[model samples]
Target chain A: MSVPLLAPGDRVLVKDDWPEFRGPAHIRTPHYLRGKPGRVVRVLGGFANPEDLAFARPAPKRVLYHVVFERPPLWHEGEAGDDVLVEIFEHWLQPVPAERQAA
Target chain B: MSTPARPESLARLDRLVAALIAKGIVTESDLVEAQARTDRASPEVGARMVARAWLDPDWRRLLLGNGAEAAEHMGVSMAGAPPLGVLEDTATLHHLVVCTLCSCYPRAVLGYPPSWYKSFEYRSRAVRDPRGVLAEWGTTLAAGCRVRVVDSTADYRWMVLPMRPAGTEGWSEDQLAALVTRDVLVGVALPRLPVALAAE
Candidate 1:
């Protein structure tokens, strides 16, 4: 899968349906931030997005996005190095500032 | 550093083993022998290899790219296991390995992974906050290096071949391996040579 090229320092948000592991569950995309915010640091990999497979839907032809987050900013009281970057499919993402549309 | 396993899970494992034995899938004696064999393996071999490689750049590269192959070069077979990958730790990036699904390890090279490496606490927390996880194991990284925790599921298992310490001019492989501890190879600890220790 070819992910749209994401440069360093590009602002992006965690896709709503990104699988919530122990980190994402407690820190980045908690219930409060279900529709909240984030930014992209680096592109991690190109592979089948977990959201599509988990939902048992047709594979949406999109690349996975990996974004990083600081712990304090994400969870307020989250510990140091709680900086997390999650990978999500394009279908699950929407523009955050209401101006930028997800590519 | 042992994480508590659920009683139900333990019971399930016991039941599974019993069933395996009853069905003749695995003999009780065979299971006992496997356990004893594993217990007899030591981490010293891996540590020694790491130390020797640290002093030798060519060997270090081989170790990182193909751990099993590198093991064979050092007289370690790494036989009876799947292929293994070795992650090299630099000043800016540290590596930690965990078996998220099960304790898949490179027994031939590094010996058995510490019990904590297979625990729920290590598996769940390491990916989330690897620095905190390492700190618990009595390892602290330099300020600049970012920690990258890797998962070793059934598909791929990892070992961290740490960077060699500075100031050892002509150290033998044996001397170097002595400095390579099990924790260092597992990515929980850093390699510290006598010179580096003195400087610190």
Candidate 2:
């Protein structure tokens, strides 16, 4: 019964220079989103942490959030036509003031 | 079983299943249930869901609100799988799904994902170039429409409830379901009213 983290439509910042969730693991957060700014779209529900699941270890459930990122901020190469919504874990995210958007 | 090229992988899978059974993590009945679930995976299930949604406003509201529940109501077992989210396509907005980290899919309702869905190029580019990718797939939206790319980076899997096509005033649910394809369910393609049933 952990407190739910990050509600829908809250702006959050992905930590900069944080190490990628390493292999020999089942991490679901994408590498490209590191240090990026996005808004939480919704709380996707709690699931046993996959990093522990990879080793058959008992995992405490963690809240997963669907965060929406502007295309231009994520990748500069392609046409900035769509907003990319990624399902990220609560541990990888931190809430930010709406005015201070980018990391 | 039709994937003959991976005998080694198949053997490895057998060994893993055997070990799971030995460890009491899963039983023979569990294995059978898993297989039965996979066996039932087909685009027909997705088509039926979409067709039902199109025909019934109450069903449509439920499907849009809780897709997994809607699937279960029709006997599509979603137990022990990720939550299902249906993104409805509209005149102004469209949705496309990709698993940038790995392949997370709504397997219970939509069956297996297409090979291209797991490719590195699709994973990397679909987020940035949805319109371009859809264009390459022969689907192009008209002016003023916006596209949204949903990355399945976690256990929350998404499927598209494609816009109901034009024509066919008196088509049956099965007839409408026939027009729904894996491509349409994934949002790369849109269902078209069969040419034979062209409307006035």
| Pairs that collide, model 1 | B47-B177, B48-B177, B92-B145
| Interface Cα root-mean-square deviation for all models | 6.7, 1.6
Per-candidate interface DockQ score: 0.09, 0.71
The CAPRI classification for model 1 reads as: incorrect
Overall local distance difference test of candidate 2: 0.82
Model 1, A9-92: lDDT tens digits are: 666555545346533321122233344465654444444444455566664455545455555554555345535434444444
Report the lDDT tens digits of candidate 1 across residue range B1-200: 66689999999999999999889899888988988877766788678667766777888778766777887776765676666667777788777776554566778776777777778777677655677778787887778777665555322356777877765557787767777888888888887767656676
lDDT of 2 by residue, B5-56 (tens): 6889889999998999999999999878978879779878888999998899
Q: CA lDDT of B107 in candidate 1?
A: 82
Residue B70 lDDT (model 1) = 80
Q: Which prediction has the highest TM-score against the true structure?
A: 2
TM-score for all models, in order of appearance: 0.60, 0.86
User: Which regions of candidate 2 deviate over 4 angstroms?
Assistant: A21-25, A101-103, B1-33, B198-200
For each candidate, give the TM-score of chain B.
Answer: 0.77, 0.86
